[model samples]
Target: MDGHRIRVGTASWTDPSLIQCKRFYPPGCTSAEGRLRYYADKFPLVEVDSSYYALPSARNAHAWVERTPDDFAFNLKAFRLFTGHQTPAKALPKDVQQALAGHFAVKKNLYYKDTPAEIRDLLWHRFENAVRPLREAGKLRALHFQFAPWVTRSARAQDHILECQRRLAGYHLAVEFRHRSWFEGDAAGDTLAFERAHDLTHVVVDEPQGFENSIPTVWAVTSPKLAILRLHGRNAATWNIGGEAASDRFNYDYSDAELGALVAPLRETASLAGETHAIFNNNYGDQGQRNAATLQALLDGA
Candidate 1:
């Protein structure tokens, strides 16, 4: 199944309870194990994102491997190490801070806005360790080290991905770029070249918000044998207008017709380009699941 994969999937890493369904669902999703079963029975690949926030116990991971089938795969997003600012700097050693300061000077705490060396080290350990059960089960697809728009095209960013390869040597890696600077078009060729050289997957996103780019688009540069699509739904108006746009979180949804149009292009693109894994991300409500079903139907030519 190396090159023949054209997977249409979903991005509900947790469940209704954790995201928007909390109000309507009331009780909450049973457990991670249960949610895995629920989605695995539906989508072929899932984009697990909680690991980007907290490391999971291997025990929990083992259950994930056991629950899903072979045709299915879980593409995980790298945690604080890749998203460095998520780690708390004050909690790190002075030596770690000093070393990181050499690269990131004038840093405050590591958790929210600063990316320190200490945080990177900690994230490396957890990221490498997180692959155990998935590898054992042969269910791990690739690790997505997505960066924010704030991460300008610095030598450090390239070096960070290089260093991360050392930590994630055996597992597959995917990188999602969120900055407009990445699209100097030909200028970003080195980044894509690096990914190809290492067999790393590049994330392609469909978002409609935030800082204007000559291309306001973020995520949509796929080249690896494997592709991950996050259809963050075209809620462009709400995302740009004052009230809802001012909200803290992402708000997106896909309509039946929109999902209908998405599959053929995706499948056709992957068939011509390479292998692809597309996941629906209208996690606004119980809509993720419904939209997922819609995409699956379109893929099946239903």
Candidate 2:
């Protein structure tokens, strides 16, 4: 592995399925602080999935910093609205919600374009301030922006991606595209080039393919600072299913052989970047936790 670091962990630590399964955590570890402490003791890295649905608060960020070790790292998912997702009006902060109430009188969902420039600026400020503690503590890795499936490869979509980077100028950003157009045919090279030019880390995804949103595993590292490999499992049947919980959609458990096959590519990615993070997103019961542990062991043994 040379001298580069490779941190392996699951995307979420507080998924209901993980807690309800009662397999990974000990008997007394029920509270948020206890669970975080326990999880940090086992893995050096974690991805904050909760930040995706709602904006993260500085208080929670401070609590996270206090609970984890100095060397621990966290990759936070960008808020849904910023990633071109259809966000519910209720997900906004109380003040923002009140301000948007009139605009959202008839609609339940809100898109990025639906917001005024001032509101967008306020959101960007709040998001940056909220994660300031993590950055100050040196525990912040990157903000993962998993764009919506509709954000295809086009000049406008590309501009929106660049705008995200511009808004959070100093922060490290990692991008994951759900639209196949970004990686289809010759466009893959162009996509990587854009990411490289902008110093954006390309999130290498491993998931079910053949669907409209499915993207092949692109092993190239666009940034030298960090590289992220997210495993979303191979559950093709559930990939595009609507009205299902995320746990149900990503329910496939990876076999040992399948995990073993990824060792070399993960190591190669680690060799190129300053740090490599392997995040398991198959949060079905204790599936992600178990797979992460097994993969970590396999990486160590190999």
Clashes in predicted model 2? 0
* Model 1 lDDT tens row, 27-143: 545676666776688778887766765665577677778888877788877765465534544434466656667544554445433554556567567557756788778777777
TM-score on alpha carbons, each prediction: 0.78, 0.98
* RMSD of each candidate relative to the true structure: 5.0, 1.2
| Residue pairs whose backbone atoms clash in candidate 2 | none
lDDT of 2 by residue, 1-302 (tens): 23579999999899998999999999999999999999999999999999999999999999999999999999999999999999887789999989888888988888999898999999999999999999999999999999999989999988999999999988999999999999999999999999999999999999999987989999999999999999999999889888737999999999999999999999988989999999999999999999999999999998
| Candidate 2 deviation (Cα RMSD) | 1.2
| Model 1 lowest lDDT segment of ten | 241-250
Which stretches of model 1 miss by more than 4 angstroms?
A: 16-29, 89-108, 111-122, 188-190, 209-224, 237-248, 272-274
